[model samples]
Target: MPRSIDRHELWFGSKLNPRRNSLNLIRLVLALAVLVHHCWPLMGLGGGPEFAGEWLGGWAVAGFFSISGYLITGSRLNNRLGDYLVHRVARIMPAFLTCLLFMVVVIAPLGYLAAKGTLSGYLSTTTTPLNYLFSNMFLKMQYADISGGPYGVPYPGAWNGSLWSLYYEFVCYLIIAALGLFALIRKSPWPITIAFVASVLVQANIEKVSVFLGQNYDFVLLMRLLPFFLGGSVLFLWRHRVGLHWIPGILAILSSLIIMSAFPGWGGPACGALVAYALLWISSWLPSPEFVHRNDISYGVYIYAFPVQQLLAVYGLHHFGLAAYMTLSAGITIGLALASWFFVEQPIMKRVRKGKSDSGAPRNESKSSLPEETNGIEKQGSITATTQVN
Candidate 1:
């Protein structure tokens, strides 16, 4: 048997040392799934197919958050808050900024020039690209309109609609950081648990609360995203006691699906737990490709795919149907993602992480190089807990 499969079997047979599980391939899969999901809407086909009022894109985003919750929490608990924040920024900002710049300088301008057929006209209409840069960079939830597309995309005007989720994910990161700090200060897990429960309760009652406050709110979006994030944090906080058995993991997934089918309103929290555990189990049990372990281009793929899809639509490929659009967009997007990772994201990340680690050497709180796992799996592997990012 291959060494990777052997390692997997050993981890499984021993039922110990589950900390070495890597989710690189899983993350890439989720990112590609998001790309696929966006193809429908970008092709001007309504808002895409939905099951139980939830689309594949929604599920994929939830999966990303659940994984982020677990991995980010693990990151914070194992590193100083400053180091944690630096790593987070390094992982997200480089690719994001690159995308924004590309959109502002290249894609939007070309689209406008294509429509207007004049340099002066394109230059005159610069507000949209500038707004896209500033707002998205700040995570302000404001999107830029790529004006003057000849035929335009179905979701015309909006440059990159997929980016809105980054804002919420950052908010979750802050919450985890605060809770991690409090837990460290108090030397207890109660504070984290209490905060998690409070967030869940607030999310559950968000609609009523929004009414009382006289404000419109996206209750479904709020409820769907936050719980999974919190669930991942909780799982990491209690990892020592949590069992990684397959039977229970399978049961939890089945039960969550059944509950979601029966009771829509209250089913979210259960689904959050189910998704988090399922993701964790898969990452832990499966043997990922060596290339996945070495090169994490999922973030690049995610941050680039939407804009590429939109560009394809702007060029009049929206009529090429879903299969053609998806295949071509994914092909171009993956190529761009590779460049983003190798040239921008990975280099910036390596520098920032190295600098932070060196500067915080005296105060480094992480034990050894890897997270201490109770399950006894020797995880001197390429992917460490701290290295698993969104």
Candidate 2:
């Protein structure tokens, strides 16, 4: 006699013991949260979150950083800086540049006003082809202050509001890169982490003392976030050391609710750190529900959300409730997500990143050996991917 198995449920709960499978899902969720924060203004909704000097916008941005903290540091902590950079650039920039181009030529020309009552006026400072190309390559100038860098004609005059977060995100990359260079020198996370932690502490405290000392830049904002960013490093440094994640996991859940509940703008960096730890705990236990992960139309939704919401609001189509907005936005976004995933994201990344062999077999994968955890790929003979991060 044979017993029937609930294969789907068994597959779903294969990791009832918890695993890192959920990292991608976390990223997708954070991206969507950012979209919601941007959409709040378009929908003309007004209800402050309960605690602290925070808002949904702040939490959303922080979530992005937290995820970055995990992925960038987690991947590079054990690898060569060059390899890490190559892989990260391959993963992040191709699609990002694609959207940037579309934004510059298509969205900027039409122009939509912002929550602050500005028209993204004179946006050519970073929105032009030359500027975007140069910045995207050499400057990483997606979100720099126009005054801080080169600006004017044929540059960004109009850009997405999300550009601000992108700037910080890139900075985090550079910080990790610099650390990677030093990794060869030091060969340990202890010294780098100590210095980083100190830097953040100093950054976090400067403002409190500045009132008596004069208006100096408060370094605390940075100090507050470094600890969380370091959390990722900790995960990598001791990936095999995890035994009891539920404690940190529960703290992650509670802190997330609290941080989001409270509208602390700068606090996002710190709270996001807490959320980072939370992510470590939950990465495997709750990989984005299969439908979301397999479908993963999030990137499309994120790119298209602002413009669509703006156009809709400008034309007074925002009378719809939040649920309806999410529904419609999801549908519209899915179309683009599918298109980009199938067309732009998949094809270009595949072609450019893949090296050709004389026999027409792929050689790029050999050049860039993937960590077991991140190899979301399966080939003909070798089966390398595992359910955990290396």
How far is each candidate from the true structure, as Cα RMSD in Å?
A: 4.3, 8.1
TM values, all candidates? 0.85, 0.67
lDDT of each: 0.67, 0.49
User: Residue-wise lDDT of candidate 1 within 177-244, one digit each (tens)?
Assistant: 78777656236555566656766676667777677656654444555588878777766666555655
Q: In angstroms, how far off is 72's CA in candidate 1? A: 0.9
The clash numbers for all candidates, in the given order, read 3, 26
Record all residue pairs in model 1 with backbone atoms less than 3 Å apart, i.e. clashing. Answer: 17-375, 17-376, 17-377
Best model per TM-score: 1
Candidate 1 residue runs with Cα over 4 Å from true position:
1-22, 147-151, 184-186, 216-223, 360-390
